[model samples]
Target: MNLVKRLKICVFTFALLFIGTAVNAQITNDITHEEAFTALLAAKKNAEDSNVLVNIAVVDAGANLKAFIRMDESYLGSIDVAIKKAKTARYFNMDTGKLGELTQPGGIIYNIELTNNGMVSFPGGLPIKNKDGKIIGAIGVSGGTIEQDRAIATVGAKSILE
Candidate 1:
């Protein structure tokens, strides 16, 4: 009887594990190249009104660069920073504003500021999500004030709205 009970428990545990994996498998979202490009273009267009050169980066949920754009004669040196910030937002699934709170003078993110490939924890990065609310990617803007960067990031991410 003891052996039989153990076998039954094992079977139940396996079934539960299988079900959990299946449910979680559907939670990840994938962003297409087209979507990424569109987001970058939108960001650039919106920034034209400000006439400030900006660098934009679109990163996958894993913080991988999916696409990027740099305005002509922009600093050109800020590209890496832009990519890192976007990756930071993609990995955290939050806007850079909240990230700033965590990385502020004595915040949790302060100690690990360089955790994401030396990405700066500034307020120009925003995560991109799909209609299903799954974070598919992130967008980052640099070369302007933090607020301006934030605005560009917002419009860039929202440009993908269907």
Candidate 2:
């Protein structure tokens, strides 16, 4: 082949290789088992520090349960609530409390809680985000008042960033 033709072929081959490699380099964002455990521990610690008994739950990017803990003496009613809260955060990519505000009467998403197999529109759930600010999972806490639950859940979600 002529010199110019050979050079053109070489450049084309390099471009093809680069494109293939770039496609294969795509990364998936999800929470690891260890990270979920760390978040649960942080939430539990926050509950203990506040002298509160609570149920904590962690869910992955797909809103699937990863870890759950119910402190001794915690209200039994909070079991499902904790899981739902985590799912709610992951589903909406925002805090459950914020959803509550938006779903209230006269709000933009009024009555939205009636959908999605039933969502908790109250406090206690937060989305866990990666260093790039992409949500990778969520944390939820229940068995306490709204404020207490929100506080504990916030601590758990923040742990993943630290």
Candidate 3:
């Protein structure tokens, strides 16, 4: 082929490659098992530091339970709470506390928690986002006071960024 024709073809190929890469970058993937464990470990560490036994739940992009851990002496009743918290965060793409605020009486979305097979609109739930700002999963913690659960869940969710 002539030099000019070859140059044009090369440019076209390069453009196609660039477009493909951009599209791929925009595709958000689910949180892997390793990442889920990492988040669980980070959350466990936070609970230990706070001297609280808690149940932690991690859910993937689909809001399915990905991993879970119940610390020793943790409240058995907290198992479902933690799972529901994680699912609620993923279902709304916001923290449970924020959802709670929006669901309060006279709020725009009052009684929203009554849907989604029941959700926990309190604290202790946070959505996990990747470096590209895409939500990959969520983490929920329970068994401590609301403040402690929120702090621990935040730590777990943010750990995926590291």
Candidate 4:
């Protein structure tokens, strides 16, 4: 091959590689396990402080489970609820309680929970936002009253920034 042709091919290849990397970088910003663990630990501490046994779950921006913990004596049934709550928060980019309010009968999003393979549209789910205000993940807590769960989940979500 001619030297000029070879140089042109090399340039083309490099351009393609750079473009691919840039696209991938824009596609996602997943949460790190270390951050998820910190959030979970904060949630556990909050639950303990509140004298509540709870199940906590964290999900990435894609609504995939990243971390989970079931405190001692927590309701076994809360395991799935915690995960669903996290997924619901990440999927909607908002707190599940707000979603619940909208989904109530005669509300704007009535029966909306049915659309997401059964999202938990109650309190206890919160989106985890980064310093740049990007929703990178979410935290969910279950096995307590709605108020307690919401408080615990809020603590967990805020811990990501602390």
Q: Best by TM-score, which number? A: 4
Provide the lDDT at 67 for model 2.
98
Q: What's the residue-level lDDT of 81 in candidate 2?
A: 95
- Supply candidate 2's per-residue lDDT for 16: 100
lDDT tens per residue, model 3, 15-132: 9999999888643578989999999999999999989999999999989999999999899999999999999999999989989999999999999888988999999999998888
lDDT of 3 at 49: 95
TM-score preference between candidates 2 and 4, better one: 4
Tell me the lDDT of model 2 at 154: 91
List candidate 3 stretches off by more than 4 Å: 1-28
Instruction: Point out where model 1 deviates above 4 Å.
Output: 1-28
Report how far residue 102 has shifted in candidate 1, in Å.
Answer: 1.3
RMSD of 2: 7.2
Q: How far is each candidate from the true structure, as Cα RMSD in Å?
A: 6.0, 7.2, 7.7, 4.4
Task: Highest lDDT: give the candidate number.
Answer: 3
Ranking by lDDT: 3, 2, 4, 1
TM-score of each: 0.79, 0.82, 0.82, 0.84
Q: Please provide, for model 4 over 64-108, each residue's C-alpha lDDT reduced to its tens digit, 9 standing for 90 to 100.
A: 899999998999999999999999999999999999999999999
The 10 consecutive residues of candidate 3 with the worst lDDT sum are 22-31
Q: State each candidate's clash count.
A: 0, 0, 0, 0
